[model samples]
Target: MAQAGFEDLVETFEFLDDWEERYRHVIELGKALPDMPEALKVPATKVEGCASQVWLHMTIEKGTLTFIGDSDAIIVRGLIAVLITLYSGLAIEEIGKVDVAGELARLGLNEHLSSQRSNGLRAMVARVVQTAAAAA
Candidate 1:
């Protein structure tokens, strides 16, 4: 099964009519994310290239990858949720092959994102892909 919030997230985004609503939805997703343990937010998991402080923790079990992440910025946290939606719960090979940029583009999020946020999002995706590749 997909992660708890994954399918609903995509459906909600598709249902929203405009960027503003989508942005609100994304923020809401961030707000709804379960809090990561403070101990897990160490520098070893810190994501580079993000203007906001962000950390990613990935676990692989029976060939499926799972992720938990956090960010100081609300929108960045939402981007993390988006990354989780795009990449988590797949086999490592599937994660390495996912076209995250294309998916973001298809959602019309890439164009609307500020350059820094876009870079941050890319950084998070890169971390997930690289981690998946390691597991593979």
Candidate 2:
């Protein structure tokens, strides 16, 4: 099951008819995300494989996982916001159960994103899942 925040996003996407509108919405979402503290952007949190510089600082408390992320590219930052909605507040055990690809397809992201962005998204998901597995 997707998180409530993600479900809300899906609803909004459904209301928007054009890809351009959806794209703009995604950028706005990114703009809405709070800045990730510079101190947390260290190599330890840096995600490899993204064309854009990206970092995700994760924390788990009482078995729930959450993260703050940033990306050098604006659209990538929006993608990070999407990922946060998809995965944050989930229990560590639940992370592996999520169908990341299937969920993304619902928003038509798979077809729209460039190969590089798709690969980067996959890498980010991998990082989150790996961290959750280790925590679990």
Candidate 3:
């Protein structure tokens, strides 16, 4: 099931008239993310395979998973926020059950993102899944 925040995002996307408005909204979402501490942007947290510099830090407590991520590019940061909203607060085992692709498609992201961005998003999802599996 989609998280409440993700569902709200989907609703907002539906309300937007065009991709341009959606894209701008995405940038605005990126702006809403709190700045990651410089110390947390270490090599271990850094995500590879992205066109822009990206990092994700994950934590699992009491069987629940949550993450914080950041990206140098504005649009990419928004994408990270989307991922955070989708995957954070899920149970460690439940992470594997979530259909990342299908859920993202609900927002028309699969059709709208550039090829490079799509690949990067996949890489980010892979990292999250790997982390969750290890924790579980």
Question: Which candidate achieves the best lDDT against the true structure?
Answer: 2
Candidate 2: tens digits of C-alpha lDDT, residues 1-136: 6678999998988899988998998899899989999999999999999999999999999999999899999999999999999999999999999999999888889999999999999999999999999999
Clashes of each: 0, 0, 0
Model 1 / residue 44 / CA error / Å: 0.8
Model 1, 98-135: lDDT tens digits are 76666777567988999999888888888888888887
Against the reference, the lDDT scores of all candidates come to 0.83, 0.94, 0.91
lDDT of 3 by residue, 12-39 (tens): 9999999899989889988998888889
Weakest 10 consecutive residues of candidate 2 by summed lDDT: 1-10
Winner by TM-score between candidate 3 and candidate 2: 2
Using lDDT, rank the candidates from best to worst.
2, 3, 1
Error of 3 at 2 (Å): 2.5
Best-performing candidate as measured by TM-score? 2
